[model samples]
Target: MSDSLDSLLATADVADRRDEVVTGVREHAGRIARELALLQGGDYGSRDFDTDSGTWTVKYEGGALQYLRYDGGREEVYVVSAHSPPDPEALAEALRDYAAFVEAYNAYVESLEGVLDDVDTDFPAVASTESVAAERDRVLDRIRAVSGEMAGQLHRAEGTDYGTFSARVDGTRWELKRERDQVSYLRVGGEGGIYLLSQYGNPPATDVRELVGSVPAFVEAFNERVADLDAGLSRVEL
Candidate 1:
């Protein structure tokens, strides 16, 4: 070939090589972006796209420039295109940064797993405090006060005509009877009631205050009956 022809051919070859380099580098960036998209999971929208060059995908929450994908090869391209191709060196640097970020994130997740592995499944027992003791004392004191008041009222109301004093409250029947020296009670629905023998037979107290206080079932039944002032007392008559 002539000298000029040889020179023209050489220039054409260099241009072609340059085009090839640009195309290859842009494609490499798209691959890196796709890898990032895979790691991204549900972080954003990801879709497979076919282009004149190849298929590519990129995931990002917004049109964030931080996503290193090409922009100009085809219409509505989600990745690098001819118009806004990524600088090869810059894309390489970003890929390195993304690698580091991925490594750190994975390490952080592994650290959390390690922490979980070290966790104790059994919960530690909670110790009671002075405040709890104080609260208990208050509750017992209230119960005792209520019991004393109820016993006094019942004693005043009791007469020689001790047929069974009974009341139905909240769909449950409760009966109180005077047996010689002690006043005994029975719950038609539940387990507790005064008896001559056996655990179920024990009377709450011989002393009036202790009597009402010891029988929680009686106290609860009495309280519910008396909740409506004098109306409850009237309901318990006879």
Candidate 2:
């Protein structure tokens, strides 16, 4: 027979454990090596102690732990995951594609630097060097936001039964989902919504076939726009 509720409650330690403490990176790799390496090791976010990294945090709840790392003056999120964080070597290999992205990103910025020489701001829309630099920064920042998100995507693939995957790029969140009849793209924001992009006959292997294959191109295409937003400076250009 099942135990009565009163009997089950006898040993439940329901009170909050105020003495619980967390410090240091729980998963050693998968995020940026240099970035994590730079973090100050000591008690940081927890109320009870100094953590290894001032900006890192680990929270335990339900049946799992959530780890997070913040960067960019702590204004940007660097890592967020609830599953296995990949080992250092694997992460490095996965980031290989992005290494080219960095090169492309820098080349784009360098070309924009030329715009500074044309100090012809008398035109109505011609921005000042400082203004252009800020705009340049915005473009690069978008690359960073997307890259961090892609890193998370590369590591976690444990769940697929739901026929859905979601990601955030430069503050804009998007979800890719496939139902039996159609594949959909959903953008999450004030006017939250979804759009049926394509109807499918069979199960759309949307994960690797779409996400992995297309993300690099997506980054490339977005990086390409920096020129039109800034004209072709260089893959970074495309």
Candidate 3:
């Protein structure tokens, strides 16, 4: 071949080689983007496209990137396009970064698996807390206060005629009765804390109690109130 023709052929070969390099890197970038897209999960109108060059998927979107560009505080990952004449070394570094990022994210997800598994499978777990116990105690207090007050008031009001009382409040059904020298009372239904509130004058000063659940605080309060009332009753001339 003539010198000029040979030179033209060589130049064409060089252009083709340059095109290959650019095309190869872009295709690689597209593959990386595709992997990222899969990792992203939820559909942001993501779709993989294939052409003669290769397959590639959008990251966010060209428009989204444009909007993010002007936002001073916004930070995002960007990739060099093969069309932009990507440097081979830069592309390799980017691939390494993507691999590391994927690995790191996968590790984070694996770490969370134990928590998720517990959440999904572990049932009847010990969810009770001190706060819960306190709340239960409060409910018990309500039962005690209401039953005691009603029992006391009825006993005083009956003035020897106080025989029996039955009432319901906030889903708690209660009954109070007097037997000879004893006052008996009961309340049921409030946060699973009530069984029976029957009482009989066992000791000379106060009534006996048969109740449910362990709420020492409320029991103390109720016992104090009833004991005081009984003491006052002992003093009255009537």
lDDT (CA) for every model shown? 0.46, 0.37, 0.45
* TM-score of every candidate: 0.23, 0.17, 0.23
The TM-score of predicted model 1 comes to: 0.23
RMSD of 2: 28.1
Model 1 is weakest, by summed lDDT over 10 consecutive residues, at 196-205
**Pairs in clash, predicted candidate 3:** 185-197
Best by TM-score: 3
What TM-score quantifies how close candidate 2 is to the native fold? 0.17
- Point out where model 2 deviates above 4 Å: 1-84, 87-90, 122-238
What are the per-residue Cα lDDT tens digits for candidate 2 across 1-238? 3556546553223222211111123333223232223332332221111223223333333323344433223242323355544334333332333334334434544665567586776867755567545654454345345654433443343233335545455444455454432333332321343221223321123322333334455555434544454433332533
